[model samples]
Target: MEKLFKQVAIVVDQDDALVKNLENLVSLTREWQSSFHLIYVVERPAFSFKNIWKGYANGRTQPFDTAEHRLKEYQEKLKKLLPEGTRIHCYCKEGKPLWLIRNYIHENQIDLLLLLQSGSRFKRQPIRFSQLVGKINCPMIMVPLHKKDYDFKNIVLPISHELPLKKIMIASFLAGKKNDARIHLLALQEQDAKRQRTENPYLFKTYQLIRDNTTLTVECHPVDGDNLAAPTLEYARKVNADLILVKPGSETSPPGIFHRLLSKFNFSSSGIPVMTI
Candidate 1:
């Protein structure tokens, strides 16, 4: 299989949990043969309190030197610690962190964005997370504070009518890359799965097309109830899913809010990359 994720980046801050996050990035992309970039945004402030304390505090260390210092340190650590021959780059920019991160993701053609929930520069505003889900083109792996092993086996996805199969297939392809990882699909509506299979065969077509001789399995189920997120999570826990894929379009539709709130959870443990299309 071809490696689709060749370039990956991690958005970091002075206070982020870099040690564990970096370790996970290495593990997640080891198969991809990927290059890692450490991105630090200075967060261009909108107002006040600048000249009031502009002098160097500790000799060469200025008021704003801490972030830069941390970024440089991370760069050294990444290059020293990553697998031999792996490429590592560090970037530090002063601007709105979101825009800088977005622009960097686009310009660098980053295939994945690894972020730690704690010490993130942005306040983890639901709107910001929702916006990233709706706008950013890369798949992101968001790690929570507690460290737990998440696997691809029993990967679950919530598919709505508006969600594109191609997008869902992206996740399936990723999970299926590992032998024995099963991709389970759940239609967010109350409609019957057999009926939908009859009505729109493409909704269930991923298995036939994606799985061939691999241990990866594909199956779709109708959620049969309201509040799709809860049921989806419940089913995922029941199946012991290591990851949950939010179908495309759920980020922009009415369930957008649900996705936003759901972002707060530490889904990475189950191999849930905490990603959107």
Candidate 2:
């Protein structure tokens, strides 16, 4: 069978910690038999002498020779971190970091993009990142610097009353592959059981579909509150989940406090990664 994330790409920089953490993510992705591609974009200073020497130097505009040499050095350093027999490629591009990454995702049909969320140093502006999150068509997995090991024993997929059934099925199919992994289908509801039964028909349909689609064990439950992230985190801690998969809302109404809180919580503060579909 084909791997889940066949073409995975990771963005790296000079930060040793970010590089090391991203290496761990690549290791985990490889464990799932996914083809990996690592790209290190060197952000060069715009005012460098190479840019100044522009048209006068044989139509050369930048210090590409030096950049290429530096890129090779980074490739060698990264190569030492990977397991043997894993095929990896490196690319060195010059531009704004996030913009470059967004373009690369479009040009190459990258299945999943892994990014290291550096603390204050590389703090992504909420508005800007939110815009990219909306525009990017594929799934993006954000891995904080601390979360390295991917122990897939427990995973939680937060579903509201309005989620599509096909999305849930896709998540179930992934969870079923890992031995002993439990898939928790959480429904955060403000109404009682009888009210949910009358109001949310899709929820029932999703429950039935999960049961019929895969042999993987799944637990369906509801939380009696409007705060989706709170209950989702509680369930994750109780189950000791290695990852939490969530679906972002539409562009007009992007993921709110519930979604952002998951990434901001103490559980995700460490090594646990969150996958947003």
Candidate 3:
């Protein structure tokens, strides 16, 4: 049988959250028994005197050596966690963070991309999920820094009348791989009563498709709420789900006071690990 994620790539940056990210990755590698590529990009400073002055005045050392040092440290850390004979490659490069990371993933034919979903304090611009989700070639996992000891046992998959084939397929594939794992399908309801009537038939159709195709256990529950994140999360907590399969439309809520009140319910800030293709 072929591996689900043959060539996994993880984005490394300067943040305290990186430790949690690495821990989660280690957990995944342990379960899958797969190798991964660790990439750290030293972003170039803007061509401004103020930027130059800040670097000099702050006595900030050159980024190449620093990046290498961090990479080595992380390499040692990962080795301690991963099983013996597991291959690990580390790359340190200088370029724009977004462009370089995306190009590298494409050039290397990465199967999965792991990104930490928190902002960095020192960097001018961190790698934002909204910017790279559409640009990347492979599926991306936005790992929440707070969520540690990640497992693929219970996966939350949000469903709509339109039916996301990719998300459903991926959920099924993952559930099939894990022992005693189950997929929870959260059927999203529309506000309009006319549209809501059509949703149930599609939900049943989706339920039937998964039940017929695979032997894995699956459940479909109707979720009611204006915001997708709230009800989905409520269900996840009830089921003790660890992973969420989300599309860009329902997951990527715009940043504002409303979003802030919900603790910024976007790709990275969902307080749960979210995957988008």
Model 3 lDDT tens row, 1-277:
3577878888876665676467666765565666789888876667799986786455332468987998888888888888888888998898777888888888888888887766443443346666676688888887766666565778988775566677777777666556587888877565555554334456777778878977778888876665566677667767777788876555444236677344334445556677876
TM-score of each: 0.76, 0.72, 0.80
Ranking of all predicted structures according to lDDT, beginning with the best and ending with the worst:
3, 1, 2
| Model 2 TM-score, 2 decimals | 0.72
Judge candidate 3 at residue 80 and give its lDDT.
Answer: 82
Backbone clashes in model 3: 0
Model 3 weakest lDDT span, ten residues long: 260-269
Lowest lDDT 10-residue stretch of candidate 1: 54-63
lDDT of 3: 0.71
Can you write out model 2's per-residue Cα lDDT over 32-126, one digit (the tens) per residue? 55556666554444676776564225322235566566556656655676667666666668666667777887787788877666554434321
Decide which is better by TM-score, 2 or 3.
3
TM-score of 1: 0.76
Per-candidate RMSD, Å: 5.1, 6.4, 3.7
Off by over 4 Å in 1: 50-64, 119-128, 148-150, 162-165, 189-202, 212-215, 251-272
Evaluated at residue 10, the lDDT of candidate 2 is 73
